[model samples]
Target: MRMTISTHDHVLIIDDHELVGTSLMLSLRSEGLRADWRGNAGGEEGILADVRRLDPGLVLLDLDLGRDRDGRMLDGVHLVAPLIDAGWRVLVLSGSSDRVRIGGALADGALAWVPKNAPLPALLRSVRAAAQGRPVMAPERRQQLIDTYHEQTTARSELRARLDKLTQREREVLAELAQGHRAQAVAERFVVSLATVRTQIRAILVKLEVSSQLEAVALYRRASGR
Candidate 1:
């Protein structure tokens, strides 16, 4: 049986599948918690409207918002940043097992990512913990996030050190190249001669220790976090 949710319901779920949403809603109700579900058709504006109307304490979100008319999966990552900015506590419940996707969601401020296949009791524990504003990452996932963070930090530091070797003019030239500007366009933009721009490009490659202009640009983007 379906439960009638009121504004006092503290939990709202956003999922693409009606069956899954209904089932989860029923399960949460059985635990004496009021909950409601929204389908993908609600869109971001609709979801925000619901949030405003419900004032839910916690939102369980799915990352995949279902397929488009062309059958491509609609990404829901874009919704995460705005939800975070709006002060919504989100817990991601998804079938996706991709570490990068899970990590990105958490990095984007999701409270937790509970694998859909996890035991119902475990999922309930995560929900309760999130509702209470507690840390919800499992041990293994926490370690994985830590390792990923360390790797990114190390890579960024190295890239910064390499970039530091470039002169101001060379850095400017590299920035232009990173934006897909050709040598001629960079020279024109900087009001420098083509030969001078080429010279700066070569120096940028040497200082960045990259073999080609594209590699230098890639390094610049990595260092700048672009």
Candidate 2:
């Protein structure tokens, strides 16, 4: 059943993509709902301000907020809890298909998610449902996403613990290898003997529980979020 748009609560769209945000705002307005688009969203402060100023009942939040004027990257996962805390419902509208991030947003209290590429009508349906304080996601499906996020977090924590076991020199060698540098090049760069660099590589592999240099480099990149 299509729920009627309630008059008590407005809608706010916080997506750094200007076109998407504005289009959503305009479409919702045509549905006889009050809507606003805030493309910049600034950062945490900007988000807080928007919540306070608009006091929207539902927020369409993007998981990747892009960046601010200073080029600092902003992750929308961090904003979900705050918006929920401020008494607004959040429905994630993100381009990223990363289940971990989507689940992370849900774990942080987002009501549900709508992909950035989802049909506009479908997306708006979710927005309206959220605004009406109705469930936008099934309980089972939502729990599955949350489980995926928790599993990834556990794996990442284990990987970090292994990475922490590396000696300072081994970490340097692993970093050089990650940059596509040959062992010979790394040795020369560090003014160390080729044998010394090769030994460090072996130690890094052992500490990271990887058998090959390639695996070691891959693990380092994964842990470092590169």
Candidate 3:
């Protein structure tokens, strides 16, 4: 079903999966609400443009919108503040279990969260509530999610600062290691001796304050979102 609504009372569903998005939109329509959906088939700019045009009452945003056509990751959380600033109320509806990302969206002015796997009745009710400007998420749970996001973001900043201590070559070497490449392979790829690679690896360890290559790689993945 397709809808073209310019009213502020409409609901918008921003999700990557077509089946999920379309089904949810249809369900909302069944309950006598105007709902629209934007998928990752288009670029971020296109999605936001359509959203601005719709000017919906509530946005059911997915935290993970997979990737765009250019292979760049497209997350709905990135749209939270932009939409909120434009006078839109957002309600996150996603399958992502990452509390940090969820909390980040909530902190960015989302009204509440409803799991993608939630039962149909519950999901519809939550959508209806959010469209009416009521948060479906519990207060304590909302605060907890917001706090987790802040804590994780702060820790990631500190980790990023430590990573900034690495030299250009050291950062490249760590990137290879983080991909599970052996130090020798990294040395070969960089056209350097194994000893030179070992030195770079040691520098990375010291800078990241990790005892093992695995720990350093984990930190790198966490900080870089790999």
lDDT of 3 by residue, 79-171 (tens): 999898778888898899889989999999898878889998888878767766566989999999999999989988988899999999898
Tens digits of lDDT, candidate 1, 77-124? 667777777777888899976555666677777887888889987888
Query: Could you give me the TM-score of model 3 versus the true structure?
Result: 0.91
**CA lDDT scores, all candidates in order:** 0.79, 0.85, 0.85
Candidate 2: clashing pairs of residues: none
Report the lDDT tens digits of candidate 2 across residue range 1-226: 4338865568888888888889888888878878888876568788777678765588888888888889898888888888888888889988988899999999998888888898988887888778877898898999899999999888888888999999888888888999999999999999999999988988887888889998988888877766
Cα RMSD for predicted model 1: 6.8
C-alpha positional error of residue 155 in candidate 2 after TM-score superposition, expressed in Å: 0.6
* Model 3 stretches with alpha carbons more than 4 Å out: 1-8
Q: Give me the displacement of residue 205 in model 3, in angstroms.
A: 2.4
Clash counts for all predictions: 0, 0, 0
User: RMSD, model 3, all Cα superposed?
Assistant: 3.4
